[model samples]
Target: MPTQQEIELQAAAFRRLQKHLMEDRTDVQNIDMMNLAGFCRNCLSRWYAEAAAEKGIEIGKEEARELFYGMSMQEWKATYQTEATDDQQKAFKTAFKENVGQE
Candidate 1:
């Protein structure tokens, strides 16, 4: 097991990452993020929901998405996400396969 301080540090890092993701939607394209960073906001939301499930806390997918996106995921998609280009789509498939890890 990690030491308490290590866990806290990781938690703080996660919060910082989540905050950045929530606020900087325009600076990061979801497809490019998936391709380069190995995950996107949707993936983060899913992981959040999975973590809740592990503790018998049932967080709905929409709720999880809202937590990550700072809005309903549908709203975020309609407002910010653009159609992926062919190269982006192809890269995302490869990257997702590599990085999805479990969820």
Candidate 2:
């Protein structure tokens, strides 16, 4: 088990990553991220929702997305999202299968 301080440090790092992705790097598209990193903002939000379920706190997907993105998904899509190319979509399918498996 990790120490309390270590857990706090990890939490801080996670916050930094979230801020970096959500605010500092809005130019990064989710499909590109998923294709490259095998995870994207949607994946993070889904993980958050799963964690909440583990803690007995109910949160829907859109709610989790809003919390993670700091806005409605529709708003975020309108403002920052771009259409993915066919190549990106193909890569994303492979990455998602490799990293996330079937669910």
Candidate 3:
């Protein structure tokens, strides 16, 4: 098991990554991220929810999403999300199956 300091360091790194994605890189679309990297903001939010569950904190999906995005999902979509290109959409199908199949 990791020491308290190690866990804190990991948590700090996660916060930095979250800020980078949610605050610094709004241009990066979730669909594109899913297509290219097999995960996205939504995935991160879900992971957050899962983590909270593990800790017996009971955070729901929307709540987790709001915490991660620093805003509602709809607001983020309105402000930053764009239409995916045909190629991106196609790639998403394969990527989704490979990365998060049937989940």
Candidate 4:
């Protein structure tokens, strides 16, 4: 079991990572991230929702995304998202299947 201090440190690390992704690296395309890392901001948001579910808290996908993004999906897309190239899309399909399974 993790001690309380460890939990706090982990939480802090998560927050820093979230900020790095959401604020510092807005230029990083989700498809590129998915292809390269097997996960992306959307995956993070989904994981956040899943965690909430485990705690008996209900959080829908869009809501969780908004919480993690600090903005609506549409706004984020308009502001930061870029169109994925064909290769990126193809790689993303494989990566998503491997990392997240079928949906």
Candidate models: Cα lDDT each: 0.85, 0.94, 0.91, 0.95
RMSD of 1: 2.5
Query: Which residue pairs clash in candidate 2?
Result: none
lDDT string for model 3 (2-73, tens) is 999999999999999999998898898898899878999888999999998999999988999999999998
Best TM-score among the predictions, by candidate number: 4
By lDDT, rank the candidates, best first.
4, 2, 3, 1
Which candidate achieves the best lDDT against the true structure?
A: 4
Local lDDT at 25 for model 2: 98
Give the per-residue lDDT digits (tens) of candidate 1, residues 31-97.
Answer: 8988988888889899999999999999998999988778887888888778889999989888888
Higher TM-score: candidate 2 or 4?
4
Model 1 C-alpha lDDT versus the unseen true structure:
0.85
Backbone clash pairs for candidate 3 read none
Q: Tell me how many clashing residue pairs each candidate has.
A: 0, 0, 0, 0
The worst-scoring run of ten residues by lDDT in candidate 4 lies at 84-93
TM-score, cand. 4: 0.97
TM-score of 3: 0.92
Q: Candidate 3: where are CA atoms >4 Å away?
A: none
After superposing candidate 1, which stretches have Cα over 4 Å from the reference? 3-5, 101-103
| 3 versus 4: better TM-score goes to | 4
